[model samples]
Target: MDDIMRAIFACIPGMRSPASPGGCLSAAFGGGDDDGEEGEGEGEDRISRLPDAVLSSIVSRLPVKDGARTAVLSPRWRRVWASTPLVLDDADLLPDDDGPQIFWRDVADAVSRVLAAHPGPFRCVRLTNACSYAGSRGAAALSRWLGVLAAKGVQELVLVFLHAWPVRVEPPADVLRVSSLRRLYLGLWRSFPDTEHLRPGADVFPNLVELGICRTDIKAKDLDRLLQCSPALETLAFVVSYNTQPNVRVRSRSLRCVLFWMSIAEELAVVVAPRLERLILWNGCPCTRRVRRDFRTRVKIGYTPELKVLGYLEPRIHVLEIANTVIEAGTKPSPGTMVPTVKVLAMKVRFGVRQEAKMLLSFLRCFPNVETLHIMSAEADEPTGKLNFKLKFWQDVAPVECLKAHIKKVVFKNFRGERSELAFLRFVLERAQILQTLVVVLTDGDGDHASQEELGNRLKPLIYSTHRASKCAEFFIFVRCGGTSWSFRTASDLSRSDPFDC
Candidate 1:
């Protein structure tokens, strides 16, 4: 409800101010008789002096039911809500009280009623009632509702299946006719439909700027076609549960950010996304099981000259390819291997794994302009052979350009008091010349919390944790998964500049 708004009238600046007696109301919904009308006028006034644009903004910011209820406030308010683009989420129509829970049919009926009541031009519509579609009408097709949405000129939409579990059904051929969509999220799908066989230039998402697909089994050819059709799509994201095709190649003209969660791409080549800024891969596994699973992915950089923030890359499994050359542990830093545009980088390393530990240097060498670095301390269960990048290994290795000059902040996550872990931290403490802050997030999920100073004093015995290299550098520690866990929203959010932290 909070983040669903797309701000249709953002240019209406200089029109908003504090509300008067009639401008702001918490519970008044135009209920008054003789005495109540007098009280409502003075206490819950409906004579808002705000401009039409500002009134729309205020109404859009409120909850769906409350925003609609503003119509009962005054004649002017009714006109404003009727003229403004509607932002409807079905959850609001469902009652929150414990008195006689409404059936799925009731909720669906209420949603239909609301949509019918509103005028044309829907800013956004989130339909979660689809998850209960089967329970309500027994495999009823959701295309009917989609048609209604299209006719209403919805600019943003969140569409989910009406069934409890996912089923791959060919949606109506005219589904893409919803050309007014600016942002679309297709949820609970086995895979996105391939429209390659459609008639030449049948229909494309001309206005679609942001797209999200969740619970999908993504295929390369289909994914490529989806991007091609949406020529104006700038942000493309996916949250796949079981990825069948591990090889994906992206070629988009308008894409700026691409994020993946709980997905696997054995070989992903960025064929061409000139304006691409952020490429993120997060969450190793799909379902949370007690046992381990393989989640290896390799990335090939082709023509993404604008990529800035990248990672959660596991060197133990991932292969980094720049243009044509595959970056290896012994590969010397050169223009071919470097990406000077990257300002923030994240990595996943099991310091215990000899092969994985050595590849970190080669990966770090690729991003020379990285200012903030995040490292996820992967759990090493198998007790791999002797660690390769210990204190001695780090001391003798060639200097990492970013560590010596550009790196200002470093965050070590899921820290456990292991010998190999301390050795890596010690090396960074001594080598990083201008390090600003070292934030360590402990994996003490056992429900115990410790302060930063206390943890630093405790670590002094195991590792002289030199008080950071730079005079301005400081150390911080926190417990309870302080913004460490991953989610589809976190992976794709543009508001949060650094998803590595919050």
Candidate 2:
């Protein structure tokens, strides 16, 4: 039976019998000699038969050390590994038991050897964990390695410092001149020097598209100069960094996305971005406990006519001011003035602060064309504060065109059944004439099945009784489970006898 199976397998297309010389199946089935021999009994190397591109792809996916080790496999693989793009990561080079000094030496040596041997076009070179340990000597070695990468035409470069100590390595000036560099990420570095020292008429990072600097001290003016240098830059991000300037101005015509998270800039101004699409600003500082409010950071958006999504603006933001008054008031724009043209807007609303709630109306007026509105409800931290989200306040404000015509969906996260919270939803239901869906995400306080049911019962009557302009508008109630996943149920699906059962 076994003989018959083998014969059948051999008869199949691209399959060979064990006795056939240099056959893939014979070698795979251990029918060939184990020793490295050039004899008649040897079967074909099936893996080596793969095309160079496919083999290169396989090596590229491996850790840099393992990828380079393919040289021992065979002559064909050796050539493929050498030509494949380098992805050197220091973490992969050193074992967990290795000390910092050993890690530094090994990583530096491996990177130098690979860069020296590889002939052309490195895809990416990532040197992490060794940056903090890479003192002046290591920095010099790194600088030389970078020069080699520049000659080889590297596309992506990432340097990460994992240790708490800052990396003292001042990146070589060649970093700015790397014509082939498209994406660059630098983290936990002491500082980046100002670009003012560049020779006159010199354009830095001409081809850079995405730049991210995290946990690094970079002066606002220097950062601005860097952006000015990269004419083709599209996405820029700064996270957990200290800025020397109080106000950072980003003026770029080609930029599309800007993300600032937990950054300590007093203010950020998007002076010009004609093609901008997304803007995200988040400050993770705990200002809830502070009595004085001096650390407030304001973001000013200017001349982004194509802007589509703007969000995660926390309560910490003093204001998201649009420099173009025409955009803010939704009036006809002067020839050169820019308007928001935003479709999706996400913001935090403090429930008990009447002034804050009124500010929401002002925001709604600014983005007159917004179709989706996401509101994160914030409760008063003090016990004596009264809930300020009164429906009357919204009634008194000028009607926002989007609420009546454009807004189709509204999401209220952290829904605690405070009077103000219900009032906010009630106002939306009454005003959003074309609304299609309303999603209410209950807080952890209502995590239990009974509490969820009770909250649902309370909201159902209030939503149903509210004068909704769109008869087709649907309501969805989401309850948190064990502070993790959310379970949702549609209002229409709930039974009349047991509305809370849903």
Candidate 3:
């Protein structure tokens, strides 16, 4: 071990002399045996024998303070912490009991010290719960920190302030110009820095691929400028952004995936982006129920020929207007109008028992080619007696092509065996000719063993009596127990788990 340590230390870039006390190899495994010469010991320093790259990786994964402590282990490792790309989070160093002011000061000082001590490139720097008490100084400190990181060619940067009051940090100009950055996530900022001086055709964030801005006060024009500057941007997410414009237009050909969550906009116009494949929108806001009023916000998907997955869509916002034509419930699309090329559709249903089946059927009719369907209950379960699902509900409705030819999987969460729920299940089972798997997850109230057994017995006759279109289709039921729920993956989901007995 001593000989191996000596050999490893000799290869390090700026290692101290072997006899020095600061030498990590000597400190880790004693200086030498009684022989007084360097290499004579049976002691094992197994970790030191690994390659330097591996050791650096292991140290990088540790908390910043823990990683910095490696400096005291041995001289060979003294520079390891300083050279490896840093991943710093302010919350890790802040004490829970410290006053907000003191917390801000401590975090600022710690970040400054780490950045000044570490040399060269940085992989990531995440600062969470920051700037709550630093006021103007906090903003300046953050700007300076970001400037230093930008100079160091950092790759990924995340700055999150979860305070109720508006964040005062002014985004550093260096952030907009960093060429090495590939991903950037900034949350809870009051606003974005102005980029009016940037040239029209010049590239900003030349290598940036993914960008997420949550709960920020960025304006519509400023966002458009940012998107225009990033030619390589592919995936973009705007969650709870305060864009007060009547329409937020995102036009990008390189983008493939877009996620809009809890944002306040009257309309989302996807004007260009021929390569877009996935579009996800969730209007549910955690802060207040008033934000639910934004559910009326409409979406305009245009020229996205490659769109394959459209999901988490609220029923109120299901009316999508493609190229000036509306696709809404009770209205069939005109000929030559491009339907969404979506294959997987996930949506929430909250209509009353009398309208549940009707609303679901209307929504499904919009996506004729969707093969996998995921349904989540948008409201509390309805009483069994209130549900009214009759065979006449499907009598007047025309057949949906996907149900007979393409739909192979269905997942229903928050299931209660109400009359309408059972009727809907039976209707799908009897109609979906190519169905392969059906997953029904019962609600927490119905999780008891007795309730589960009774529900299963009630559903058994329906399953046996119905003439299923797919002879090989199987049904699965998942029940919650002690707060956690068990899951069974089907063959279609690439699993070989045994089928549930229920």
Local accuracy of candidate 2 as per-residue lDDT tens digits, 291-400? 24546667788778777777656543555566634222233333333344888787887777655665566667667788888787776664334534553555565667
What are the per-residue Cα lDDT tens digits for candidate 3 across 40-127? Answer: 4645656666677877876776666767887766666676667777776665567646565554666767778888888868887766
Per-residue lDDT tens digits for candidate 1, residues 134-197, read 3234334455666777888998887655334344443444557788888887655545666667
| Evaluation by TM-score, superior candidate among 2 and 3 | 3
User: Which has the higher lDDT value, candidate number 2 or candidate number 3?
Assistant: 3
Clashes of 2: 4
Local error of candidate 1 at residue 432 (angstroms)? 2.1
Clashes of each: 2, 4, 3
Order of candidate numbers by lDDT, starting with the best = 1, 3, 2
lDDT score for candidate 3 against the true structure:
0.64
Worst 10 residues of 1 by lDDT: 3-12
Q: TM-score of each candidate? A: 0.80, 0.78, 0.81
Q: What's model 3's TM-score?
A: 0.81
